[model samples]
Target: MKINYLELKRVTAMHAHEIQQAVNHVVNSGWYLQGEAVGTFEAEYAKYCGAQHCVGCANGLDALTLTFRTLITLGRMGEGDEVIVPANTYIASILSVTENRLTPVLVEPRLNTFQIDDRLIEQAITPRTRAILVVNLYGRNALTDTIIRLCTKYNLQLVIDNAQGHGLSLPHGTLHSAALPSPSVVCHSFYPGKNLGALGDGGAITTDDETLATLFRTIANYGSSRKYVFDYCGRNSRLDEIQAAVLSVKLKYLDADNALRRNAAQRLIGEVSNPLITMPSAEYCHDNVFHIFPVLVKSPDTLQRHLQDHGIGTMRHYPIPPHQQACYQAWAALHLPITEQIHREEVSIPCNQTLTTEELTHIIFAMNSYDK
Candidate 1:
């Protein structure tokens, strides 16, 4: 009755044959970097996201970094300009901002949804604020109508950190107006464990702006637009051919896999009831792809140990708030109670497409039976 938090091996096994074939094709093709495979995945992924362009990079952080860097090069934003971000998200989200010499205005997230509070964003906007980097934390849609309207009214650039939320769609009939920035960008990551994972690290940025896409590709390729001709100071961050080929295969099953994740998550939400455990609000659950099915408890360490004893596994989505991290010591004094609380209490249980029905039942039973 052993249930690991997320067995990537089993997940990979589901498509091993196709993945192997794709990788083999790449190895035999004699061209790895910037080849047909990369081009094909980029176009397919862009179409999947309803964007016109997709620029592949080495990893998720690079995707975020290059997006802002490209925006700066286009004069859409510049150094020291502020980008609003969630205080509770993984450090990579904030790192993307600081790495570009841009300031990150950390806003707390709603405890129920574990998403950046759209209500708090407007108040955080100041003259220096240039963009809103919305992270779809834990595969949930973080974009709200309020945030979109604010972005429109203030003329701020909208950037989406979709590292955890691949295949999530905006609410029907949303984002169709001329007021919003044309070609709004969404960044994606294909780390080995993500919903739309590759065998190795990979990422891409999707946008309708041809200029931004070209610049992103150039920046990721050591700032070279043409052969040996450097445009702007950039670095090597191109998605390799094998990973791109693998991703192209996985992309076809993403929606179906996400639906399976949703089914498992819904069962957990509806069935798990414990005084010591608090589940996320169901309001966003239907829309969420359930990258991580998180729960709050009084003692996450104790719960983790308890689950381990039961041969069940668990992980913390995060245990430290970004603001509290020592790297940003200047902001150490900032008090964000909600964000701190989430970091202290959150634990992610198994909720991937790889879990079996028996395993899922065991998880719910183990959770409900816990007296500690």
Candidate 2:
């Protein structure tokens, strides 16, 4: 009855046949990069999100990197450019800003939501402020609407990093925080684990603006619309046809799959009555797609070990915040209380869409068995 912390295959089983067919079609056609599959997937995904356009890239990291790169190409983010980022996000979001030589200002997360503490954002802004990078954390909408308003008021470019929040949305529509920014760049990662995960690494950039979309495509393909021409100093990164096809099949059932994850999360929330463990808050945002079912315990390390001993695996969402990581220790002069607090307490339980009734009960029993 052992359950692993996270299993990627449960949701993917649905699209196995269609993905194989799409791959076979690509192999026979011999046109892999920038072909019909990639184009169709991008178009379909964009339409699904209610956006005007989508540009496919090699990986999710590049999606963010390229988004910033496009901003650099447009003369938006330069050496002195300051980009505000939440301290609780994944490192890729921070890398994109730093790789472009822009200064990244870390902000704390809100107490309950684990989202960027909007109160701190205005204080972090400076004369060099260029943009605000809003991340959709925990597969829930995290202060995106508020961030957009702040960006607008502050005259900053609203960059949307939607790596974990695919298929998530706001009250307005299907787009996951896409409508907020004027020259906004929404980046998604299909890293075989996300709601819209590809077979391997894949990502995309979304924008309603035509010029930015055109620029992103060129930047991702070694700065050339026509091969080997070298329009700008770009690198080679393009989504292959195989992964695109797989993503398309997965995309069709993303919402339904998310609903299943949510159902699983609800089951855990209902049965677990332990006083020491704080259950994950149910989201009000309809766009919420449960990527991780994390609960806060008094001691994360002790609880993780306890679950493992009971044949139920658990993991910490993040052991360290971005600023506290070894590489980013140089920026340790600044302090962020809330982000650091989240790192110490959060633990993701064994949650996957495929867990059967028996497996789920086992998982619950394992967690409930852990003592203070």
lDDT of 2 at 319: 82
What's model 1's lDDT at 55?
Answer: 89
Worst 10 residues of 2 by lDDT: 281-290
lDDT of 2 by residue, 237-310 (tens): 88899999888888888878877787777788888878778777654233567677767877998888888787
Q: Identify the candidate with maximal lDDT.
A: 1
**Candidate 1, clashing residue pairs?**
none
| Tens digit per residue, CA lDDT, model 1, 1-372 | 899898889998999999999999999999999999999999889888877788899999999998999999999899999999999998999999999999999999998999999989999999999999999999998888898888888889899899999988877522222334665788999999999998889999988788989989998998998998997888999899999999999999999999999999988988999989998887868568888888999899999998898899999989989988999999999999999999999999999999888898999999998888
TM-scores of the candidates are 0.97, 0.95
Report each candidate's C-alpha RMSD, comma-separated, in the order given.
1.4, 1.8
